[model samples]
Target: MTLPDPADQADNPVGGVRTTSTVSAPTARAAWSITFLVMILQTVNFADKAVLGIVARPLSEDLGLSNADIGLLGSVFYVLFVITGLAGGFIADRVRIVWVLLGMALLWSLVQIPVLLVGTFTALIISRVLLGAAEGPAGALNNVAVFGWFPKSKRGLPSAVVTSGTSLSKILVAPALTVIVAAYGWKAAFWTLMIVGLVWAAVWLVVGKDGPYSVNSARERAKAGSAGKVERVGFLRIAALPTFWGGVLGMFALYGMVAVILTWLPSYFEQGLGLSRVNSGLLFALPSVTGMASMLLVSFLTDRLVGRGMTVRISRGMVSVVALFVCGGMLAALPLVDSAWLAVFLVVAGYGVGVASYPLMNVTVAHVSPERQVASTLGVFTALFSTSGILAPWLTGRLVDAATTPAEGYTTAFQIFGVVAIIGAVVMALTVNPERDRARIAAIDPLACADSSADDKY
Candidate 1:
């Protein structure tokens, strides 16, 4: 259970796993338990990130902030999230992922707990910055941890399930956090997340192993010598890949929509639809719950389908397009709806679509990129896309400012999101590399229809 001391990634390529301790026995049950633990940590990870958004009003009022200022909170997290994401990937490529996750989980949990003390905007912002910093390592290491544990074909479902951490966190946080705020004031939300985070850290220690090597992965990697043989690349070479930029643009838009919705949903419901804070929180949690289900369904189908020979373009990209279409439909219908609750339902449905896109797009990015640089490339990808965190929230806030009512904001913001998703679908459609993507899937799973013998006919 020894951890890698933080070090330069270049000195030891496999993050110096040679220093890692003994391997444990592998079993279907242990893998499932490990997978569940990953999901729990992920839940804490996202719950902390999302609490500010879920309880936006009370916190903002206590700190004397405006919509524009609230939006910037996302910026702090995204900035750190992006920067850390870059470094995390590199570290993941070089480091012992389990230990990296173990350390990050502990730090990030402590960071989220401090929001209880901040009454001033400056203090709140500083608190957010600290939380963001902790999140950086958590986000990066989590990806590496996932990659280290699961095979490529099997990775999609487990990854998506783990990724459902965000959705599940929102599900719990939106409703429960809203209630906590109503009962105990804004500070309770932060304290609550802090408690949950610390608990998750303890759980990880008890259940989490160092890597696949500690249990089953060691035997599997030994069987496939190529597992540990990936080469590390310099930043400049990684920067030059078109696929890198493509990932950036795609992820940017993806995260942009996600960030905007996270930051704006409560405000939109309260101000636009005129729902009470408690009601809005409860309603908001609904989509996220639905999103969790959709995510698992999409990821499971993705792995099985791709394993059966579906193209990445068709599998990942097309599945993502489903979210865009639904989101668009929800937006387009917003203005026409008379019932406030109905409109809320529509928007929540759109969020469901947003949930579906998360893991599929990530897996797509991983598939196209070289494995050695997956973390670095992913880091840059998250950073650039998360850069949208800076822009989308501001623009959406402006849209909120201009709207005559919460309903109007809901209608307008959603329409804009719909158009954005449509454009994304078009771009994704043009980039369908089914054959190449098929090869990528095949590389991860021997049974995936990646054989040259079948290539010519397809």
Candidate 2:
């Protein structure tokens, strides 16, 4: 099939240039199809991350591992995460993103092979490290790819949809994996994920193609003189913005909390709350149900607000600030609650409310960044915050090991993260001003800002 020249199509307008009269129905369908496919990729990506947590009890028992050892296993997966995330972001900016995604998915499948073959702790660490490296860039790359399919005004919902893959993993993939662990064992779950990754890669290889608003398409438009002059900016200059740092700090807290949830939540429910494994899995899935709904609602509303000419400060920044605060409050109160069900409610509500920040912060950062530098900027943003992944799991393990009781340790950990989330809210409230940041960026690179505003218009 011949690819449609972005120069000939007006549907995927960029930089305020309209090459055609109206967007075609086919183009819209293709955009959503690709968006959903990327969403599925995210589902698979997060499933890989959640598998260890789901099987934590069984894996720890079979291997005769302690809580600290399990935490270390969780921590090890992030050893190369930040570095690879940065490198992958840069790579995605220069290369075709479809190829980058395909490669990562294939590597994800291959990394599981070692663990499947060798069930030792050392082998597991090796697998985790490799998997971390492969998956580190997945989030940023996926968002950048999805952003290429939709205009600036319409990006929020799509971004939410893409990131919601994490919630989907918890809600859908986690329970299924838990069942597999219960019936067939932890190793069987790894085998299942490996096969799933390979299957996704095969399908992606055949169907994946860069979208009309992609970097390649931008270059093509430039060449055709349809898109105005495309100018690039230094990554450092972009990173120096207050908006960038604030979004990073807020996202850092959220990711740390997410790491704790992904690495230890199931264990927490089973050990700390005295729930059976099956019940714990079901409880674990509960938060994502709310999280998914909140995420979609927030994103959809943000897009609508932006369409109505609302400032991103209100549309994106304030929303994130509020979410962080709500999340922090609920998490902090988790330990104070007497009932196990109440504690569960805190986890579910806090996580559900706070997760709305992910897409908002992402889109906010993207708004301030030069279009060409978005992937790299997002990479740095993700890399810095994702370091929390390394620290959170390890520290929680240490906390649990040091506490007199597992329940006390778990409560303490949740309280600390809750405080972190509140602090994130304050930071976001002070620093996130996308309108101001966009103007600042415009002053540094006028053409970049022009392109950005033009893209936002449609």
**What are the lDDT figures for the candidates, one per model?**
0.64, 0.85
Clashing residue pairs in candidate 2, if any? none
User: Per-candidate TM vs. native?
Assistant: 0.82, 0.94
Residues forming the 10-long window of minimal summed lDDT in candidate 1: 448-457
Give candidate 2's whole-model lDDT.
Answer: 0.85
Task: Rate residue 241 of model 2 by lDDT.
Answer: 85
> Per-residue error at 179 for model 2, in Å?
0.9
Q: Give RMSD (Å) of candidate 2 vs. truth.
A: 3.2
What is candidate 1's CA lDDT for residue 76? 70
lDDT of 1: 0.64
Give the TM-score (vs. native) of candidate 2.
0.94
Tens-digit lDDT track for model 1 on 231-318?
3335554454444455455555566777777777877778777878878777667778778888899889888887787766677777
The clash count for each model shown is 10, 0
- Output the number of the lDDT-best candidate: 2
